[model samples]
Target: MNSIEVEHLTKKFGDFIAVNDISFQVKEGEIFGFLGANGAGKTTAIKMMSGLLQPTSGTAMVAGYDVITQSKLIKRNIGYMSQRFSLYNDLTVFENMQLFGTIYKIPRRELKDRIMDSLARLDMTKQANLLVNSIPLGWKQKLAFATAILHKPKIVFLDEPTSGVDPIVRREFWNLIYETASTGVTILVTTHYMDEAEYCHRISIMADGVIRLLGTPEELKKQVGVNTINDVFVEYVKH
Candidate 1:
C-alpha cells in the first residue's frame, strides 16, 4: 500500500515556482528519502505533504487524508520533526515527552507507560529528569524523534533530522529510524547527506523545483553511471 501519493503537486510564490508539478508515491513502511541541495524545493514539497503549507496547484494524499481538504486530519495522523530542535530547552526530558503526549492527545492512562517505554529503548531513563539544554546534542535528537512519534502516527516527516550530528551519532540516529520503520510507520525524510540517502529504501532528488532523479540507491548509481550517490547528485543537481 502507498502511504503517500502525490500528483502534480506544485507550489508557487507569485511567478516563481518552488515546486513544479512534482509527483511521487511512498510505499507503506518504507524509508523514502527526499534529497536535494538548498533552494531545490525539497522543503516546499515536504511542507505540502505534511500539511504545513498549501500547494498552489494539484494535490496529495498523506496517511489517507487529502492535503487540501483534509489537512487537519492529515496533520493529526502524521509526525513532524524539523531541522531545528523542537524541544523546550528549559523542560526536562520527561517533561518534554509529557508535553508532546498531551499535544497528541494521548490518554493520560497510557501516556506514562509510553513515555517510559520510549526512554528505556534509548537508555535514557536516567536522564529523564535532566533539562533538555543539559543533555548532549545526539540525545536531544533522539528525544525529539521519540516525541514526534509518541502518538504512534501512521507517518513521520523528518526534515534534516541528523544535519549537524557526528558520524557515530548519525548512525545511532538512523538505527532509531530503522526501528521505527520496522513497526510499519512510513518515514519520509529530507537530507543533504549522500550517505544518509543511501540508507533510504528509495530516494528522490530534487533540482530546480523538480525531481531530477528518483530510484533506489543502486539503481540511481547504475542509471547515472556513478560510483556513489554524491557523484550522482553532482551529475544531476550541480550541472
Candidate 2:
C-alpha cells in the first residue's frame, strides 16, 4: 500500500516554479529519501505534502488525506522535524514532551504512558528533567524526533535531519529512524548526504526543481554504471 501518492505536483511563486510537475509514490513502512542540493525544490515539495504550503497545481495524498481539501486532517495525521532544533530550549525534556502531547490532544492517561515509552526508547528517561538546551546536539535531535512521533502519526517528514551531527551521532540517529520505520510508520526524509541516501529503501533525486532519478540505491548505481550511491548521485546531480 502507498502511504504517499503525489502526481504532477507543482509549486510556483508568481512565474517562477519551485517544484515542477513531479510524481512519485512512497510505499507504506518505507524510508523514502528526497535527495538534492540546496534550492533544488525538495523543501517545497515536502511543505506541500505536509500541508504547510498549498500547491499551485497537481495533487497529493498524504497519510490518505488529500493535500488540497483535507490539509487540516493531513496535519493531524503527520509529524514533521526539521534540521534546526524544534524543541523549546528552555523547557525540560519531559516538559517538551508534555507540550507536544497536549498539542496532539492525546488523552491524559495515554500521554503519560507515551511519554515514558518515548523517553525510554531514546534512553533519555534519566535526563527527563534536563532543559533541551543543556543536551548535546545529537541528543537534542534525537529528542526532537522522539517528540515529533509522540502522538504516533501515520507518517513523518524529516527535513535535512542529521545535517550537522558527527558520524557516530548520525549512525545513532539513523538507527532511530530505522526503528520508527519498522513499526509500519511511513518516513519521508530529505537529505544531501549520499551515505544517508543509501540508508533509504528508495530515493528520488531532485535537480532544478525536477526529480531527475528515482529508484533504490543499487538500482540507481547500476543504471548510471557507478559503484556507489555517492558516485551515482554525483553522476546524476552534478551534471
Q: Which portions of model 2 miss their true places by more than 4 Å?
A: none
The 10 consecutive residues of candidate 1 with the worst lDDT sum are 230-239
Q: Compose the digit string of candidate 2's lDDT tens values, residues 133-224.
A: 89999999999899999999999999988988899989999999999999999999988788999999999999888999999998998899
lDDT of 2 at 112: 87
Superposition error at 159 for model 2 (Å): 0.6
CA lDDT scores, all candidates in order: 0.94, 0.93
Q: How does each model score on TM-score?
A: 0.99, 0.98
List all candidate RMSDs to the true structure. Answer: 0.7, 0.8
Give the per-residue Cα lDDT of candidate 2 at 30: 98
lDDT of candidate 1 over 1-239, digit per residue (tens): 99999999999999999999999999999999999899999889989998889999998999999999999999899999989998999999999999989988999879999999999999999999999999999889999999999999999999999988899989999999999999999999999899999999999999999999999999999999999999999999977
- C-alpha root-mean-square deviation, candidate 2: 0.8
Q: How close is candidate 2 to the true structure, as a TM-score?
A: 0.98
